[model samples]
Target: MAAVGYTSGDPRKVNDTGDTLTGGLVLSGGGSNLTVGGSGAVTGDLSVAGRLSAAGVALPTTFPGRRAPFRDPTRIVTHFQTGHGWATSGGVDAPTTNLNDTTDFAKGTQAAKVVFTGNGNLDISGLSSIDLTGKAIRFQVKVDDASKLSQLNIRVGTSTTNNFQWQTLASTATSKLYRSGEWTTVTVGWADVHGGAGTFSLDANRVPSATTGFTFIRFQVVATGGNCTVHFQSVEVIDNVSATFPNGVVSLVFDDSWDSQYALARPKMDQYSYRGTNYQIVERVGQAGRLTLPQLRTLQDQSGWEIAGHAYTTAIHDSRLTAFTARQVDDELRNLRAWLVANGFHGDSYAYPGGQFESTTDGASIEQIVSRYFSSGRTVLSGYGASTNVLSEQYPPPRPYRILALSGISDASGGQGLVSSLVAAGGELDTCKRLGSWLILTFHVLTTGSTGGDDGVITQANFNTLIDAINSYGIPVKTVADVMRYYT
Candidate 1:
């Protein structure tokens, strides 16, 4: 059956301004085939006919070509090759959406992108899906603007929970963009986003009450100042069934403090010789001590204490802005950097102090206050292997630092001993499915007190036991710095 509707001209209803027209039609139980030809006009504007839409055009079965279905141009991954060129500020060049341009990133580009204004969304209507798997939505973007960057945002919602406005899977989510201005590619795939009712619907009639599906892809300018321009060139959405992690990424983190511990590991420990009644150890605790030329030589000869910084506080986590003042943050960063330099260690990655990056979840922008100051950072968040949302301007996940956390030895409150307590307390091995990410873990002297003596410092036996347990659990133990290179 071929049902077509059309209109030519007539005394159509016009608005007061005469700039627009209105019309309506209702079709009930129609004939086997009805052809309402040349009769479609709205607001009296029938000067031209744009397209001919059929009521239904059933196909034989299969078709191909699954590039893009709908586009509003809000996200960089959805720019989809606009003929009009785009530009960026900060004297930086806009990133290319072409797959050939790879850089600061090693994971490879999944989408060609350009930034766009998030507040005013790119208007799209009467859109259709090409794949129809209704599994997930997939797309990528890149934003590396240093001078100016908005909170990369994306939101899609409906009028009511059940009474929807749009019938797409992308219905709700508030997102932000990074201001780094350096093209950061992004990918959004809803194939993993699950829902019920057998098939997904984006019509205003179907709304999800207790399910997961999107209605829209609303990209946003994350920072402030009202507007932004993003460039997006291509898009490819696949089902959740095919998602895979990036290639060859290990556990997150490679802290520099190990160097100091290693320094303390060799010659220093060799100096203490067992005499008649006691070991002749001669390094004062707490207070700095002047090393006599003879003692220094003897110690050096006995053990090799490599020239390294004390590594004062490699940061348990990134600066939690909600946890510190500007001065405090500056001081902490300065102290860490100066200590690293003084100790001959090239300051690269800083473990987030308190296992965090910003102070408060809603305080001064993380990128504005922190990322700009540091080269890279690592965090304790879990990983999906491929998409680790760590310390990123677009999607800053919980504990976003360097990599996705896979497991941990100690609990946050520092409780150790007893299998029941440890189990009840639960180690940090993630149970949920991550999208392929490098997991990072943190550790300190596991004791009930402080790090000064036989009281707080973890006993060598306990340390070995913990290491063995982590190994048994199949979680890898790594320092903080190593993971930063993978994501940031």
Candidate 2:
């Protein structure tokens, strides 16, 4: 008495959510069109293991979407692998990681620091809290069995003038974590910092003379030398919504700044090169912000990374996405996409800078048009995208969601894992759709000290742990562009 396959709906298609294939899963070859829609049903073992994808008549390199082929990259913005020895890959912004170097922090060779740079005043306007404690951005630093660290905490805001005049909403860094020396991970929770705590606050406020504000944050380490290595695993910033990996497959994309580098860590962004090229600091936004070539690499090397376009500030209004002009928005999208193609990127994902809440109220047609070009997108509704987000249900059109955190937003508070997401998703993994998936994470460096940055800029060590979690969950972490190709 084996279970029969679903007999309705087109499982492979991305319509307005409710339309779906109901039965008969298959593993046979060339069975894409074998969809048992609203009127068909399968009572046997349905298997479609070999089938030529949309690009061919025969099974191609792999089953369509089975392996989710990687997009060709135009460059490398930032990359690291604990298994690969934590060597720096593309572009350089902060201190570089060299697994080959005897100073490998993971191996306890030398000490490392997580630096954050930005335009002083952060915005942390709508979050619940900002405390970092057991919940800290973790990074794996391998010790050489002899490296010693006197300070396990952080030194933020030392790169700017405002220092640390921001408020502490809610944080866990009230104390610091000492490196145990065995793949030692340190946590600089929000409790460890305070308002006007400049010097090492990494809060980049506008200098007194600059119209914009201060412009940099450097996470430096107070270290005692030894000889080993530190393999950077991942950088996890929380509370962000983004279009990633498969959604907007591309050969090239541009990030527009080097501030994120400092946010990830001074060493984490060192000598960064992507697809085998180094990114240059293109420009600084006075106190407004800074743009870099490597930062641009995030757009270029999107084969693995996801890039989202944000409204040029001022896009969110009463939850009815509004801004300079539709033409302006269109221009931004076109420019961003063109840049990707120009650089050799093939991805087409879009992570709205503002969130799902920005769904245009009077411009439904305009939003729809944008949707046509991009595939399967989500505007944070009421679910945890990391685990609870899925492909089946229709999201609320008017945007019935709110973001407690975003990857790059500054947090004068505490956050970690899926706390906010879980709360938003209402703690239901069952609501997560397995097919028409959409994920988005947003970030803003200039807002951290005042407002709050998306918690996504996580510690390399914590990032790796998160990677393990995502992989363990069996949900493929895709670039937004790649996801769109299949959905569209």
Candidate 3:
């Protein structure tokens, strides 16, 4: 039978076996499969239904497979104890043999063992050539009796006369402690070790210049109470970098049971699948112009919003709790908790009413009460200066409780303006993305009509726009409870 070439316009039929397609070929029929016997190029996206096989084919070396090599800018400049390049000073005695075979060594087979006798000290050097500029030094050590060792210090500088010293027993956030009979890692940042005087006089912000990089690095151990033996190993200089955030988080908190939030703002948030927190004053529930129990419960169950405790009465904010007696503050918190429990709410968080609190007088008492009841408590922008303000800074290390600083969306005179608020919100979001930090933005009322002079009311349109902006940034929105869980 002769092969027939149909030239009809019907796509069901291949017009000619020898014909070339100028534009492209489209296979639209159901369950139709096309096979290419030779190499082919797809300039656009190619959708595949079944498995793609390229066995025995010579593929391009740059073809996408695993991700390309990514070397983190933060890394170790030098590593020691792998071989010999060590020296010791003072009356201290160095280990006679390699201690790598012993289980006491943290890493590698070789370690520096210093024996402290009476009031004498040991100074270990030889890392003078390696650059310690803007880098932190870390080493592992095991002590026979940590109590007997009076002090352990590290000195780094361009020269002996230009040295800056840091004491390990200072108990700063970066300080490390040595445990008795067990290996403990000690990390000291260069910024923390700067003594602010000497020939080097390294500033906290300045790194060592190329020409005058640190030429001396020493570890000194002083035995005050008694003599002890210490094993040190795995000395390294590492760059200090901010911790990476797993997707960058933003937590939305609505203070006070403002009626506009339940009516105007929540629906817009629901449209985008975002959840916020409502810090409710139990006394305001079922009031004439505030969020009722039904509304709060609906937000909690349907909208996936968190309902946390505020204060019992509208007259007292968290900061003003200092004015009230200790008994009064305790009563209000207890009542708020009871009200939440009776109303079928499981709140594990609290927010300061006005972000004001007296830390000296009743602050400790209030914190103690909050700690006993809730997992976390939040406060408004307490610190005034930009440097001291928590919201303006990057997310700090995790703590059991955080005085979450907030940036108000309202104007300085206390009026809700979309343009300024959006600018402020975007800046906060950018900071969070840059530092991989957690940002908590506080919102109050969402209203179309103003409450006369109320500064907290945000229009629905502006609210939606703000939410869209946050969504465009690809930042994950979390509730107060979620943040507490993550940080704690």
Candidate 4:
């Protein structure tokens, strides 16, 4: 029943007394080969807990044609369980550290409650100086009433005055990540933060050196003429911020089949010898302000673009997967794919209408239904709002039926868009190149102005600027289908 003895000759030579190892056998302790005799059979079950190896070489957990688990390189900065030399400034009260705050905590039974007395920061320091190059700062925040707070910022530096900060409320992409009465995880990447007056130097010395290290990281909160309370947890530095693609791959996906995108953006795309994916709502084709059927054909037959599926209803909002009933959801997906195939488009890939759809809800029925008709389904948000380093699809996404994408592109203004600035977009490209991930940039409308001026609109000049940057990066700009084919 139980035979656990090892001989020296064969590394882990198990001396079995019974014909069958009843419970199970675990081969451990410096073994190069798991030699079940040449013609022997694995009668019952053999479980390798750590890893399986052969001929003194370890075998890969991930093989070709399958996605690999993310290499998580996470360094914990704090969990607010202990008084780790934390302090407050600018009239802010000191953190009320709680070791058993079950009612107000994000992770463990520990959380830090901070009341914003005025306009100031709650900071922690005395770190061992770790290099934060190509890393991101992630944390969870739960506010008593988020609407009461006018602004929130995550800052890092060698000192209070010498730091780089990202205003979460300054951008639309990041602003959505904040919601009161619930915990929100915020991720700020290395390239997203900017220096202020008398702060750290630019680029060369922006990130604290291994010697100098980071002195303190603070959450700066601004109230709308009153005080507010917030809880913090799980502050971490993530090194493997994104999954690696073979190389940086960019996919320009224009949703809704906007006539402006086809007319204004297509030519610019052609100028750069690039193609895009057009997620057309079936009912919108030939409708005023939308791409006509012929225009969609030209994009496919002439421009080398992928005309993918989007919606089937007369209006997109009516077809939103999140708002649909089970019957409606089934009808929408089935009808939408049928229309795409009938209209001579790639009906294989799908873009959820309004960037709506869930893979985990409803027993993953929506995802399963989508998978029935489409090879891949794309969504607008991947949950890491505005952090370019973490904004990309894994080479072979864990969920092919529900692929993740970054939405919105606009001129650097209120930081309302995903790629609000040239630097942000460049950061995304750099991340893709460094991590070998896929950067799928979503667009809606194209205009001719310095600023995008409205939601979902990127000015013509800015669109051109994006194209120039993509070209400069030397990354292959492929259509969604093409990228899927190459990777899959």
Top of the candidates by lDDT: 4
TM-score of each: 0.34, 0.31, 0.49, 0.58
304-383, model 3: which lDDT tens digit per residue? 89888888887776346656765567666666766777787766678766653333254344655555456666766422
- How far residue 40's Cα lies from its native spot in candidate 2, in Å, is 52
lDDT by residue (tens digit), candidate 1, 77-164? 2434433132222322235323233333323343233333333233222234233222233334444442245334333332122211
Candidate 4: give the clashing pairs: 171-415, 172-416, 244-435, 244-436, 245-436, 245-437
Residue ranges of candidate 2 with Cα displaced over 4 Å: 1-258, 261-291, 311-321, 356-364, 376-464, 472-474, 486-488
Query: Which residue segments of model 4 deviate by more than 4 Å?
Result: 1-71, 82-100, 170-175, 196-199, 203-212, 225-227, 240-250, 259-275, 286-310, 316-442, 445-466, 475-488
Q: Give Cα-based local distance difference scores for all models.
A: 0.30, 0.30, 0.55, 0.64
Q: How many angstroms is residue 194 displaced in model 3 relative to the true structure, after the best TM-score fit?
A: 20
Best by TM-score: 4
lDDT of 2 by residue, 1-488 (tens): 12234344435542333333454343322234443334444445555554323433222221112222222222221123333222121122245333334443433344332221211111112222232211212233433322333322222232434433211111112111222333432222221232344333322221111111223322223234432222332222221111232211111122324354334422332223212111121123222445443544553454234433333233321122444345444444444444544554344444444333232334433344344334323332222212212111111111111212223312234443242332232211111221112223323232222233244333344332333333334444333344334421
Answer with 2 or 4, whichever has the higher TM-score: 4
> In candidate 4, what are the lDDT values of residues 333-367, reduced to their tens digit?
66777677777676357887766564322533566
